[model samples]
Target: MRRLGSALLAVSMFAGCGGLETEPSPESLTSPSFESQQAPITTTDVDVAPECKGIITFVNTATFQTLDAYLPSNVVTNLVNRRATAPFTSLADVSSVSLVGETRLKQLEQGARARGAINSTCVGIFDGLALSTSDAAAIVSLVNTIDDSELHDVLPDAWNGAANLLNLRPFTSAQAISNVAGIGEVSFRNIRNAATLSRPFEALAAAVNAIPSNGSAGVQLKRHFDWWNEVTAQHGYSQGGPTCFGLEPSSVPYGATIRPYLANSAEVMAEVQSTLDYVDADTKISPNVIAAGMANLSARTQGRSFKGCIFSYADDPWSRHNVAIFVDTVNGFSVFSETWWAE
Candidate 1:
């Protein structure tokens, strides 16, 4: 096994003499590029309380008579006059009306609950398990269409995630929702379960049976690669080697073939070692190469803590290449490592 310093030096020397081909600019392995890609995904800073279904209708759409059911006559009259100018935009606005306060708000909430307009459970998650597929689908639908304020009120801890979802609106699949920052498996599951209790989400849920599962591992790996390519292009790094290889995208030889495979951490480690041994046998490369590669990979990954995949590719048969992509399914933290041998 070689130290990273020596391995990197060897790679550079070999590359300069045309004796080996490897990823360029190992320092680029840091996550700045990935972080930069997040800029366009969240464009909003507005923060307002969400409007629950029953509360929204009560304040913005209910008749005077309907208002009378939940409030004193004087308060109803006040609310009616207020609505004549403009419909309330949020629960806070409703609360601000003359003669309405915490007690009145509670009345409204209770009334809505009694009439099936809202569910108490919608405000929080009580279950620890993942939501059912239908439940998850319902939440995804709500997240896709709900305004940022509403989402904020519904999922208070997910303010940043909600903003991201707003920019990446109309999420057609669960995987897309899960990929958003600040939304992890637990949060998603909570949202799903909580959404099942809300009238609006329930209505939408009726039409959706399940949120689409992220495709197989191979599909996900390809998606990650495609995302990297897109990001590199957008950031004006298209002329550089592939980011997966810690180099600009342009470093990938034209027509180089990439094949992705689903693998456990153990499988990925095994393949890495095998590739290193094969290369060493063929070219007598540095004894530390395998150690350096393994160290690089381990440092970048979370071992069994996340899902992993392997991509094997070659610009030509004489060269061996592998990239391991790891995704923290819980939080959507994705990272990759590239190891290659070239003649």
Candidate 2:
């Protein structure tokens, strides 16, 4: 197999390009041309623990609620105040659409898709490309897991090797949450440098949204191949190899033994409490449920940050397929809330 440096150089030379115009860092590639509206999805009902009955009330969180708490809603109206913002790239294909006055936009999406290829980490990248209603339904059918059509999988590959995405790439859930402060900058930089490609923000957004919330670290690594070309084009160098080829590979987070919990309400409470206790006692990091929710929203808003926390649900409220809550991809961390909720 080709090494990373060799592969990248080979890919770049074959494409007849040494490098496209250097663009701003991923931090500067913030902001999409369109504005996204936030709507709340119905939450699944879970029994509340008596110990925390009133403390954990229902908070209606819409798609919009997950922003960095810095961007204004009416971005279009306040063009001057509107900062660059990466729009959420849902898992749908729109390459064949023919909306009035949107021909160029459709071409843009298609070009972005072709330019920003897929990888092992984002094997589902094509699934996230925004498309017409027919295409959306088709992609939804392929997901085959969740019932909700809107909840497309956020595969981890979205935030990997591309040099421009370095700022957006996250190593941990906490880092993902903290990166929101600079999303606008990333969005701007991506758009400014689109001449090298077409629409970096759109392409990157599609990659980010295609990440699945559940999968092994290997699945995550596989998706990394999809974007190899984009990485070479962006960095002005050729490189290739398995996504996580050289980096010392590690197990997904929370992929180990699970703690047992009773099915009763009080048991559920104890279970959740225990999970938090485990996070605190063992890793020195307690579960920050609210903060996690916000981080997910922020990641969606910026269309970047691919780190997520996956909790295992079999026994421990935080049980993952294993332990350490391995990130399926690079998007925002998943809280794996089912493990903590009342059964």
Per-prediction TM-score: 0.26, 0.19
Distance from true location, Cα of 194 in model 1, Å: 13
Clashes of each: 12, 82
Candidate 1's TM-score: 0.26
Question: What alpha-carbon RMSD in Å does predicted model 2 have with respect to the real structure?
Answer: 23.3
Give Cα-based local distance difference scores for all models.
Answer: 0.42, 0.22
Model 1 per-residue lDDT tens digits across residues 3-29:
000011000011121111232232332
Candidate 2 local lDDT, 1-343, one digit each (tens): 1111100101101111112123222222112311011111101111111111111110001112211122233321231112112111111111122221223323333333233321111111121122222222322232232111111123222222222234343323222322344323233222111111112222322333344433322111111121222222232111111122111123211122222221222322233334434323223322353234333333333332222222232333433322111112232112222212222
Model 2 ranges off by over 4 Å: 1-94, 98-103, 106-161, 167-273, 277-325, 329-343
lDDT of 1 at 281: 27
